[model samples]
Target: MSSSTQPSDIIIGRTFGALFIGVTIAAVLFGLSCVQSFVYFQTHRDPGTTFYKLVVICLWILDALHLAFIVHCVYYYLVSNYANITAPMDVVWSFKLQILFEVLIIQGVHSLYLYRIWIVSQGRSRILPIIVGIVIMSNSGVAIALIWALYQCSMFSELNKIEWATFLTLGTITFADVVIASSLCYLLATSRTEFSSTNSLITRLMVYIINTGCLTSMCSMAAIITCAVMPTNFIFVAIEFLLAKLYVNSYLALLNARYYTEVNTDTNNSDTFHNRHGVYRPELHVRALDDDELQVSRKDLFKHLDDTVHPSRSVKEPALAVTTEMNSFSSV
Candidate 1:
């Protein structure tokens, strides 16, 4: 029935064609999300927002994914780098598979922040500082490894080599991310601390970050599996971009540290004001006490184990709110 390809027949055939439309669309969206998040974080900063710094930390991860996918997209789709895109099906899938884990790492970051916010908001003091170290080590290591793999792949000319190299590396990154991210989630879900609304403002952002990170990980996993098995897909490129965008936009949301908690220490009892993204406001807490109050500033509180006299690791509950000896703010 080769009648110069009838209009109806051509349309039907094209519709059923094996074109990688799904992957292509996803890549574009991921890239845009990353850029959005990146800009969001930079514009948002208030010195008092202690937790927002973590959000800034989140920016680096999203940026990495964005850049990785950018490289992947250029190499696969762009004119000059087109020579690098050749591969059979499953082998080419490694690039997209790798990107999926990268996105998951970003997601894990958001989850960790969310848990912290939840802990602070609830005033649950059970959170130890060491957890931060575990997260930093685990996530950063995988990201570095993945980026290294990408560089290695970039330098190669053959498909088999890229597959052999990236496949194992990506699998390791994914496995590690799942373990640590799950631990963070478990910590948050079981947190018992309950801070007043005074801690609500900034705390809200942290919790929100966690939720966003969770959603991202859940959805990205499915996409990665499909790409890994299918390969030679334009869809992979689009998904990569979209994932990048998600990472970046999430970081941008995190830049709103000022919108959360603001600490004001007076001569007597320290006052805590809990803000919820500049919406619900509350009166400042005023109390009478000695010039010496047990109020810990973010500066005094190291990310984790810096206190030598009473090493926190030894103690189950390390005092983040270290009773300061210095007096900066006077009484009213």
Candidate 2:
């Protein structure tokens, strides 16, 4: 081999090696996501959870497709075109199609977060969620444009021509993530009450939101920086491969968190009062809270404590008043 050809060979190896590592990590995360989805379905059987179940199903399907495309792209370059020096420079169809799946998965997760923000604020803070929604939609638009541009490119070098689209797509996503995390943290912080248990739960939620948001944002930022610094390298493409899986797993993680919250609350309130009158009294109230509709108001908390402390008061007739309040956050 000529001396000059060694540099190109090293680059090809690095590119495919990065692709392999990214896809491997993505597959691991996808497996975790599948487990989370199964747990969600098994634990939450109420009819109200149909929407969330559907969301999980849809995202999982999209993630499967995305992974398949990535595998095909890697196979095309590394296996199908083995020993061909020029193969790395050519673009494959799967490489272009995966962007669409990524955009859809990301949008789905973002929309769910936006819904949570709206619910946490009890529809009072409408402007922030709306603005975030607009930004998310704009990001999706740029991602579509980026996919179209990728489709137009026949060579790896051609990606440089559409750097703007790449930057905008990643930039908007990171921005939205930051905004969502900050908003959730700020809102939850403000909703904190004097109760130690409630405050503790709120703190846990804030920490979780911060961690997940930072994770996805950091991945996006890394992709943007790598793409800008080394447009010819496959490092950015590898990062892109991981982005969708991260979002999907994040969504599933959030959903599955309800189980932990429930267990903790139950352990803490093990001696909770149950009506002993057995006259169909409206004293004991136990309700299952949905993940999306997890709201705990101060009034409800005070009422629950009051009922628990003073269970002597009973209903005049055979009446039942059941109120479902999530143990986690009163306003999360």
Task: Give the per-residue lDDT digits (tens) of candidate 2, residues 58-153.
Answer: 989999999999999888978998878777777788888888888888988898888766665653557877887787788778878887887888
Give the range of the ten consecutive residues with the poorest summed lDDT in model 1: 305-314
TM-scores of all predicted structures:
0.42, 0.77
Residue pairs with colliding backbones in model 2 are: 296-330
- The lDDT leader among the candidates is 2
**Residue 319 lDDT (model 2):** 16
Writing each residue's lDDT as its tens digit, candidate 1 over 64-148 gives 5545554554445334433332322112334545565654645565455444434333333445434544544555565566555
Which residues of candidate 2, in runs, are more than 4 Å off?
A: 1-10, 47-49, 271-332
The CA lDDT of each predicted structure is: 0.41, 0.71
